[model samples]
Target: MNAKTETPAIPEGACITAKVPERGTALLGDVVVNPYKLAPLTAIIRDGGQAISAAHVRVLGRGERGVDIAYEVSERSLWTYGGIPVFGLYPDHVNQVEVTYKLDGERIRERYQVYAPAVRLPVVANQTAALPLVEPIKVAPGFEHRLYLFNHLLGEIPGGRAFKWNALGGAAEWDQVGNNWIADSNGDVRWYLDIEQIHDSGRRDGLGGTMGFQQTRDGKLIWGQGQTYSKYDLLGRRVWQRALPDKFADFSHEIRETPNGTYLLRVGTSDYRRPDNKRVRSIRDHIIEVNEAGDVLDFWDLNQILDPYRGELLETLGKAAIQLPEGVQKQESTAANELLEGDLPFGDTPGVGTGRNWAHVNAIDYDASDDSIIISARHQGVVKIGRNKEVKWILASPQGWPERLKAKVLTPVNAKGEALAEEGGLYAEGFDWSWTQHTAWLTGKGTLSVFDNGWGRNFSPTKLAGNYSRAVEYRIDEAKGTVEQLWEYGKERGDEWYSPVTSVVEYRADRDTQFIYSASVGFLTPEKLTTTVLNEVKYGTQDVQVELKVSSRQPGSVGYRALVIDLARAFS
Candidate 1:
């Protein structure tokens, strides 16, 4: 025998015809697997003649670790008469899918055996493991039904020829993993966005990846990073991707859809000049609203709206050398001194990672009821501003504020409506302002919910040992200029649950629960390993219904935020 050749096995239901199948026939037509190359596990079922009014797809589990993933295909015009998209298949396995769809007022059920090849995730420099190592710690009853999306940062050790600021190891490292992924309650990876499809792989600056991953009302996913933002459908179809206008640079943190279909972006201004006409690069101090055409409709320059030189909290944390992570003490204290000693010059400073890291804004939310914007500034405080750029109120301590802005600071009040005593920026027993907070959003009941990072609490360096982070809710009376604490969690856990930076708090009205993400937990440990913890706590009882932890073999892998995604709602 000359040779033995083996032919590849053809997948069941694979399209083999030379001509394209026609639509509007009596029965189902050709089935094309992975029609969109980006989504390898998804398939499209071509419709025959009848219009599909509804669809439900289920991918059965394989082993003990696998769990069934199911969802309904949306009946939008994009899919009613066209091919039905199938999601939630397992990788590298022959998946058994159960599909139920309604066509021409009649119900039809079918079975599918689709094979999805395994995909190899990108590996960062000096790291052997791939991205995203999810570990489930606690899964309460019914919690397994929900899926969570994590924005992961893959830590890459810098090469030789270190800079002066290399002492801040974890803080100085750049992220190599640039994609956001989803995992079930059982810790199985379900889906992820191929960031290279929208962004260039060569460009990795300014947070190094995407953030603010959220779904729009029309079931499209959106995120912002570096200098661009993108929108995509669930089937990995790119709707549109746009870069910041010429005047802006480094779009970080957040990008959310407004009520009128515009987008509110947290971005940095280009060629920002100081009051003395000194040109300098600004970072994380600007917000812009843009239309679908990427035209800037409005902008908010914090340098103009607020006091940029007011670095009371920045100075406090700098002096303590506690800005980065807790136990990782600064090798040289001069970095902090240089930033606080005098007015910063035009160029980048020694201590600051970027140019002029003042008023480090990390989050923004739009209030459609009054067209106001709420922002969480890590260096300043959570603030709400009117459409005219006038400060409606500030949710921060009254100390060290300019007289004009101090008047806008809200007073802490007790449940009984009594003003709480403030001593050195510390409020009495029940209420305290959020410190280094993130994700300050208005809840359905009109209360403000914040992830109080509790950094530099009470603005006292000596009180650092008692610091703790929490998901806190406050009831604010704008007319009375007062805020009352409604509920809180995580303080009781103390330092064990503290997250020095980057976290989120979300309220789920349907479940009557609060989702809290402690993204940077244990960042300051001696080992330098970081763990992300997510908890779903019942509102009134304060009982944790679900607790999930995400860790990685790659040291210093830290998560920025975790979002609970309801697949059925997102797809349908």
Candidate 2:
């Protein structure tokens, strides 16, 4: 929260005039690099329970002796990872910095503690239970190993269906060549997954999207959205069917498979009537263990696990409000400004017995490495559940990260280089009025990154290289649970399409590439892509779909091209 500062250090020939996260400064460059890939980084750090990556850090300036160490930790690309975007480095009081990492055959155990670098930090500590199995399926023999990502609760999508939530129930199988990704869009995470083949254009109630496994069987179609149809062969033919008992609840979530090829899904009612609170979708979120034949073998639910922390931190965080002393009052008001602590990324789960029957699941992704299932809570933020039903990570957003009323007036950068937030404006969302959009993740060499779709204001005179829509990146410090801003691109990046009112966000880590593929769906669609970053490159390829193509070429038709400038070669 830069208040009384201005004249930020920027590379020469960079954007001379523009906004930060909102109105992006455009740049000129040939396609030497896609420009949209990821920016290089010199540092990385991770902190807290949730894994975050940051780019820069203050090495304890030799000044204020043992004073508080405040650094600029940018997190423009945070929400893409199902987290929040809190750019800048603030006061994270710590006396020492200690880090320890262990590398075993194929495992890595790294502990990071900022208070004391000599000791390690505790990322996660929880109890786990054992689960028994029943059925067994067939797997091709001679397979060395396997990886899977599973979601326990097949939930629903939030934000009215435009985007998926991060906390979803699904599973994915990963290997060297490729991995089969299955998730339950049932909520936010895609649940249905099968690496071997592609199922029908999987969808529930015949919706365009569904949660099911992806397998290739000659072209047959089978979706696990409702778990009704039997398995299909390559020829679009059902090879096996299930004989469901009439009175059975007839459904479930968390479909985990055994090494022997057997699988099960968790089942439950919308909300179970509890003695303390009765209206919590007892049927909504439950853990049902079933055999591959759609038969129930075992079951569990949140009601069973119930707040393991026993309402200690949850309650403390709930009522924990930081009191700003009178002398340091940013906004002097008689009402003693207090700060509320909890900030869940997705949405906040009603404390204990709120009796609120609403839970929105956004997206789900399977992690084969540790066999953990990652889910996004649009209201809560992030929740990672291990195979044993242990919530390894319950990372809520930092209340300080958002609503910086006092932090705003101090935000630097004013109009005409005024160096004031008000004059220059606080955040210019390249486009205005956009509530929020999609996001993607990126991890490579030295930076853990995210693509922030600043969907607020669409137009700004300060765009640099391309057209005009903003996408920001952050250097993630997973070990320290931190993030730093790396770069911002939008119309200045030679893009014709300004930030869309609403669109999809996805990241392809395979090609070490991330993309922000949006559309002009909502409020205003600023003539999609006039010119992409390609046309500017001497060897650029126009065949690529970056530029907008309009045949009539009318007065307001789309026909934009990116302007490339090879800075490296320019000086030579």
Candidate 3:
């Protein structure tokens, strides 16, 4: 269809803009645009079914010539929401946009007034009023940092707020909350704004989503919406987006920026069918080097590299492999599957899928110190790959496997950092060692920090009593082939804090604090939804400094990743 020939003439009052008036000012602190949460202005154009060929926004500043801002607009597809699309606005600035759209044999111009208002948040002066849902706990006092949270999926709350996708084949009741919050030293939220909504593909699979909804040093948001990795500017406009190759399939759970202007993305390709018509869910993980502009620079597939060690992995799967439940096979083709997983945050359906989520890579962290990368595989174990792509070591609980198979795994060290020669590979059982974990990174002290979701914490064969989650730090001595547990939080909280799915652990040296954010803290229950909690604690002593917990206020709510940083530093 030739757009120019099919387009019709413009109608009177054809160009208009709609504003979802601000409910109230959220205390956004300053006038600086926080790129991670800026809302872009929207406009509509009606041209008698003539498509808008091209459109641009001209921002008119005081005493200055208009600055043209490039905008990406398309016809609205949803029937209920009908509007010609316009976006890419400057936040918190009152200005006039001279919008021009190329139509049938002519250019139509329209001027619209728009404003991005600033929000003034309240100071947390009282604990009782800070959070009214839970009991009044003594919060820390006089805090100055802000917390950014990216929940993989937010189940519909009691209120009318609803997310767009429902992977469970139920209602589209889940949403992604990319929110920013300010907390006092006592851990009470003084100000907050639900800046953006995102979708996390791995939320429902018991494997979490991207380890980051992180803002780059230059204030650009870098995140994964399923198979595609995208970047958005401060004005909430998607500036760049890149998808994995068809062979690479979809993003698993992590993406990180390199010292150079590039990214390390963890993604996977499924090998569910063979030439012989056999069916098996064999997910092969890979790490692709991506440039700042969202181009793939390089890639390394772990499956090919670790194929020799397949027997070892099979042994590690042991009881888990046998006990795994069968799921439904999707009726769609791979091409159709790709379309479904594209910009949206849904790839493999949680339970109803053909492939086994084997080697579910959930987190990737680059160790610049050693020129290596540490990856967390929820179904297997954490593996460190050197610059040459050599598997330096594999760290796991090594319990379910046969004693002889433990030789293939790494050894562990005691309190004194002394290697237990006989106890190599097998760490203390029952929620002590790493298992079904997410988010692994190097601490300032050169130890590995992990968010252990405590999956299979109470395996039937192992019969471990408790099922709980915790933020744990381990000192790994590659030279000695040993891993030592340095410290942990939530070990005493029991299942009350057992977040089996999404979570994060951040250790801040400047503030001597450890922040633990959980997406679903409550027991995975059907009667009620789960709650997410953000806890700030004294780093070394594990003293409770502050705690901010929020839920959808609806049954079965869940969230994803969380982190805290200085707001001023983040923006400036």
Candidate 4:
């Protein structure tokens, strides 16, 4: 499908009339379902995917602020270019009205009366912000510990200098204590593990950042790289890193862990080669398989699975169209004269997988049960991948990752598929990030929490410059790869602890006490009122207590002292 941007005249509450490619799909096909108001209407197709880009998304409006879309049909897990949620629209099912450019722009339409007959609000809707901290609530308990590392700078030079963001140390698993190890992902390689004082950088010089993990027991751990799954002993010694490279082309995207002690990594580049420079750009999004010793075993690619042909309904391939899913146009044979030594075929440059697809990733997760893998793409929202690098299902985000949630359904539900109100804040348009993902976390109860940073500029309503960030926790209905809404982290409903465009995870389970916990947005240090200002409730509950880490550091100051907040008032 043609992926480019051109302003289309959008009229409110009128028959949708938008730009159309000479041939292919439009942003909105026709009669679409509008879930919020519960009606349907004719909507317009705004900015869609594109032919080429350096970072998957090139901010459209100003600098680095436009909508980023993957025109590939099968991979239509649409989000704001920044991994945030944008509204979704399809033909004959739902009508979508969007206002992505301004802070107040909202393309409000009625709900589809005929579509989704069974979908209804759990209780009457109300606009308010009040969420009570429920039972089993507490920041992650901790001891005197810190593991992992960080990259101080964004490395973008030759030979790739090792860097760190903020590597922390502690028990790796929050659901279990026996599995105590510190781990970190320096926004690069995820290899900083601290297992009972086992430090085996091997002088390889590794960096650290967001997350970390390390096994507690003694044995060779299996973590996959490209083609080869590497093995590492308890002492951080490289036992062996090996994998059959048949599908290990570019496994540098990301990684996750299996409860069985295995590792799940990514392969394939998310960028595309430029026809002008013959240089592949932004080719860095993919999923791979890895083991403890850091060996690459198997791999999968969203490019081969999401059929772009389906998007042809919106528009035909442009002169610079990248490869679409399932529609590989057989290339014509070219003479050696047609080849260039400076082409991407050389070692220094990146590959152009079929010379088509763009840079967009699916779901990313690590399973502790049966060591399975779950990946969703901006194009293909859901995929169940296994250690053998096999795809089991193509699923959708839970409850369609509902951008909008009713206050009543926000309550707890029974196993028979009922809804309850848990909090009150927003009816979100999920994963509408303009640039890329901010955070993706998996809970022990099969919950996938996503921090969708709203940043897209193309799809309308992106220009609004407000604190428009939120966090969402998804309870996966594995039978359909559908993510159901359990909770959201935002200010409207009081779910957010911090308004961080960038945050980290500190998850753990207390083995001795049988407790699961977390503490982020700065360590448990006092003097930094960041945590309390963002998350700690100043209210009172019979069970839950409110606490804060007090510091004399003025609100707008530069540097300040760090100390831990003491136990104070209860809120629950």
Clash count (model 1, backbone only): 4
Writing each residue's lDDT as its tens digit, candidate 4 over 1-572 gives: 11124332333223133222233323222332232131111122223333211111111121121121211111121222211112222223322222222112322222122222221111112312111111212332232111122211111111322221112111111001011221111011111222212211221212211122223233234332222334443223454545324433433323455555556555443243433434332232456555555555655544443332222111211122332233443222211212322232322111223332332352367665756666544322334556565554443322212122111112233344454333232224332221122335465645655544333212222232233444455565555333345444442522233322233221223221111112223222332222322122211111212122211112211111111111110000
Off by over 4 Å in 4: 1-153, 156-247, 269-286, 290-297, 308-359, 368-371, 376-435, 438-441, 457-464, 480-482, 490-507, 511-572
lDDT of 1 by residue, 212-276 (tens): 88878777778886667888766677788776788987676788898889998887766766544
The lDDT of each candidate is 0.70, 0.26, 0.52, 0.29
Candidate 3 runs further than 4 Å off: 1-138, 142-144, 155-211, 270-284, 307-355, 399-408, 420-431, 458-465
- Measured over all alpha carbons after superposition, the RMSD of each candidate to the real structure, in angstroms, is 8.9, 26.2, 15.3, 29.2
Stronger candidate by lDDT (1 vs 4): 1
How far is 464's C-alpha from truth in model 2 (Å)?
25
Which predicted model would earn the best TM-score? 1
lDDT of 2 by residue, 361-420 (tens): 233333444655443322233344566765544333222222322121122222233322
* Model 1 poorest ten-residue lDDT run: 1-10
Q: Per-residue CA lDDT of candidate 3, range 47-151, in tens? A: 444455444444443222222333333332211112233333333566565555655546556565556444332222221221212212435543322334334
Per-residue error (Å), model 2, residue 63: 71
